[model samples]
Target chain A: MSETVLYDYWRSSASYRVRIALNLIGESYRSVPVDLLARAHRAPEHLGRNPQGLVPVLDIDGERFTQSLAIIEYLAETRPESGLLPGVAVGRQRVRALSHAIAMDIHPVCNLGVVAHVTAVAENGEAARRAWMQKFIGEGLAAFERMLDHPATGAFCHGEAPTMADICLVPQVYNARRWEVDLSACPRIVAIEARCAAIDAFARAHPDRSK
Target chain B: MSETVLYDYWRSSASYRVRIALNLIGESYRSVPVDLLARAHRAPEHLGRNPQGLVPVLDIDGERFTQSLAIIEYLAETRPESGLLPGVAVGRQRVRALSHAIAMDIHPVCNLGVVAHVTAVAENGEAARRAWMQKFIGEGLAAFERMLDHPATGAFCHGEAPTMADICLVPQVYNARRWEVDLSACPRIVAIEARCAAIDAFARAHPDRSK
Candidate 1:
């Protein structure tokens, strides 16, 4: 095994998803914290590594990989013994869709960058920012809750074990809670989050646990 | 072969992505147009198919699949003859990451719902909405341009043949251009889009070509 280094920010929900996936897969990786608040991602050094300037860039054996869901799927495929994804094609698609619903639909709407963009233009300042965050997060999460009603959902987001969907879900839930968006309407989501939190892998991968 | 019915809106970039994939695979499917302007997606029938109330739901043998990328990947896997993804693990991950770089990172930020939210709050009207759209679309397309600089980018988003990445990129670029975001900064993306557009499969699947 080669040295694995993850460029990440503690509070980035995308970074957090990758962290959970790595932890679940039992891969040992060093963390290089990127300060999102300081906009370190846009710096030249980070840009050279990832032109998109996004965190959770996984460096494995000197090769760099970006995109949290893609990194997690890479780990699942490369380290098949960890079994982060199902073997069957349809099953994999289902899991991927569930993961993407959270990654694409939910997380992107309330990201810090988007919120900041809204605040930059809105007349109401912080209140406007908060409102913008709440509206998107609320709608996205409610849609996710409806998705959870699928028969595939079990203790985790899919089936009984932790899969990529769970990896994506827990972090988004954490971020939503941080923003004070109520999750009471999403019982299935709240339940799954609790199940994920109980796992040692998820417990160790929480944002506050990292340096 | 089982009947596959696709519920899609003609103008939806996400739906356009799925159409490209379907054409690439040469799959015969019925198209059920959902009117976004009339909120047809939010109707009881469509809501049951996809609780997210989104378009591009691919119903195969009574089971409906939501999310454009997921449906595309599922089709690719089930109909392996088309081989939309690479055979090797690393190459597959690269393609997926590239697809996600656009699908997750770019599309959601400038989505119709988010833009509507911005306009509703703006009170300053169409100018504010356009500004909000331009800001996100510009940043995202520029970032996407950076991602395209990698050697992996060929005539398409991945290798010579159009894959999921190209499926995602063409529609996004089309949307960005519709919003009048300058594409001069992304010559690579423009080149890729031109290649994709030249293909009969992509041309037939384009938004303007759809019923």
Candidate 2:
């Protein structure tokens, strides 16, 4: 692939997920920051690339891609040797389910846009937003921990290796922490997050280290 | 598949998506309702089947599957002739992106749980919630329309054949209408919805027609 460019935001959980995927796959790519605070993401050119106006849009191999999970799936499908997803159909389905338990159920609800909307309407915006995050994110993780109770969950969400599940896991943990949601009830998730954090790919992809 | 069972709720957009998938593939599955309004999804037995406490859990070949998209993908992969996804790599990614633009971006924000939470926190709760649905659902469809602007789109989200994009699209339009979100700006989406509504599989899977 020639000239792979990822339009990223330093701290967007969605972008962070993609960064970890790229790092784990051992692919070198350039990052251009789209500052959400400065409204860079709302610019017409960026919207032209991704009409959703969401971050972590990847342009690679002469094509533009949106949606972090979809981008990671594309990478995994094209680079099976990277082991982003398991080979078996059932295994892939399990990983995708675990991934969606976070991506679909948690992340989208507490997204910045949603938070902004909540803030615009909520009377006690700060407390309400924090409570909202804590309730949904914490509950979602509790359910996720239950999902990890399955025999297939090992060091990572799927097996011993980090599959697409872990790619989603780390960023969500970051968001939970960012929002100050309690994770004491989710020992399995905490343990898996620790395992992912120990890896250089996930460690370096941390939003704190990003430009 | 000895006996296929779908634990479904009649009005759930997610469950509705799976019903369409099952119908399109000519898969006969018994439907068992899990009433979200009664909080049956939170019961222990249902929780055992899906820790996420979400609907549209499919039981096939003695295995349980959750997450509508994952289940659809699983069915498509294990039953490729069903053609739920496109044949090529880029095509599959595009379909997934389109699907997520609804499944993730639009649906979760407008979900009953999230909206209930929004109402509990927000002032002028009803109006705020309505605006929330209208704004996000409207913008999401507009972006989805832009996605359809590609050469690949035909009668459905991708080519003349109904793929996962169409599967997700039909229900989301159902939701937008249910919420009274205007579709005047989304001609492509409206056009696609009209086409999908005319088809037997999609028509059969409509929430209004569900048992």
Candidate 3:
């Protein structure tokens, strides 16, 4: 069989999300690190794998894929028993919404490239990066906490098992802690993060472990 | 059947994406304007519809949904013939990757709130906003144009039909023109936008017409 390979940056929230997904599926894949800090993602080699020059590009089933959430969806579609997403349409929608609440709303705003641009453009440089991270990560998680108040949210973001929502959540929580964003207002999120942290799949996918 | 309603700000790129989806699905929905400029989205009532307090909160099939891409996924799943996504897994992944290239990568960074914050922090206010818009939108669409270079890209973003990718592409092109981003570098994207603009469903969903 052709091997599954994941090209990822250890600290990228998007890459972290897909790492958890591959672990959950128990898919043994080779991990090729693309260091974002060194601007390695923009190199011709990595850009060839992804025109966007983003990480967590999985070369699987003999085809290369980009976009972490889309990669998760592809994995879920092919490996339904992995439960990366739920079965029913509404459940899947809820999962997708919860995932996007982080992937689209929070993670993108805190992206390394975006933060670098913000820091460069603003007067304070380092201070601007810190403040940018805190404001967006703090506010985005607060809204996510409210979204979790729904009855569908259980030990994980969706139900008893860790679905795509939890996969997206763990990495964002990692970012929050990295930025020292307050988690006091997010009891549900904190609890959910704690639950996901205990899982082998999620635990193995941690940035610290990956590094 | 219960009436379907879409709570959206006419000028929101995210809202515009959903408007195109609903129009494409041939699903008639009551358009409830939640004006972002007036801060209607953050109001208590709108928050009740979506705790995220974002526009393009879709109420359909008796379930209220948030996150524009997720709502489009729901529509595509329920109405497979709509072809918001492709039928095959690989094709679906391609469509989603294209959709998210804009939705997750570009749109969020240039989001009204994000840009407002950027304008506030940078030395120059309006100039910062304009520069921020032009840089991110221009670069993003350029990368998107590169993505469209694949063999899968036909008349539209993915194939002969307009999928979710096209729904995402049109609003972004509107923003590109609104920001006066140089599209001379993106002939393929420009051509695709022209095709989407001609379709009645896409035409009616334009922020101008919605207003």
Listed in order, the DockQ scores are 0.77, 0.87, 0.90
- The TM-score obtained by model 2 is 0.98
lDDT of candidate 2 at residue A79, scale 0 to 100 = 95
Candidates' C-alpha lDDT: 0.86, 0.91, 0.93
Model 2, residue A108: C-alpha shift (Å): 0.6
- CAPRI category for model 3: high
| Interface Cα RMSD in Å, per prediction | 1.3, 0.8, 0.6
Please tell me which model should have the higher lDDT, number 1 or number 3: 3
* Runs off by more than 4 Å, candidate 2: none
In CAPRI terms, where does candidate 1 land? Answer: medium
lDDT order of candidates, best first?
Answer: 3, 2, 1
Which candidate model has the greater lDDT, 2 or 3? 3
lDDT of 2 by residue, A160-210 (tens): 999989988899999899888889899999999999999999999999999
| DockQ comparison, 2 vs 3, better candidate | 3
TM-score for each candidate, following the candidate numbering: 0.97, 0.98, 0.99
What ranking emerges by TM-score with the best candidate at the front?
Answer: 3, 2, 1
lDDT of 3 by residue, B1-211 (tens): 7789999988999999999999999999999999899999999999999999898898899998999999999999999999889999999999999999999999999999999999989998899899999999998999999999999999999999999999999999999999999999899999999999999999999999999
lDDT of 1 by residue, A1-211 (tens): 7799999999988888888888888888999999988989989999988988999899985678999988887888888877688888777888888888889987887888888878877788699888877788888889988888878888877788989988888888887887799888999989888988999999999988985
Model 3 residue B131 CA deviation in Å: 0.8
Clashing pairs in 3: none
Q: What are the per-model C-alpha RMSD values against the true structure?
A: 1.3, 1.0, 0.7
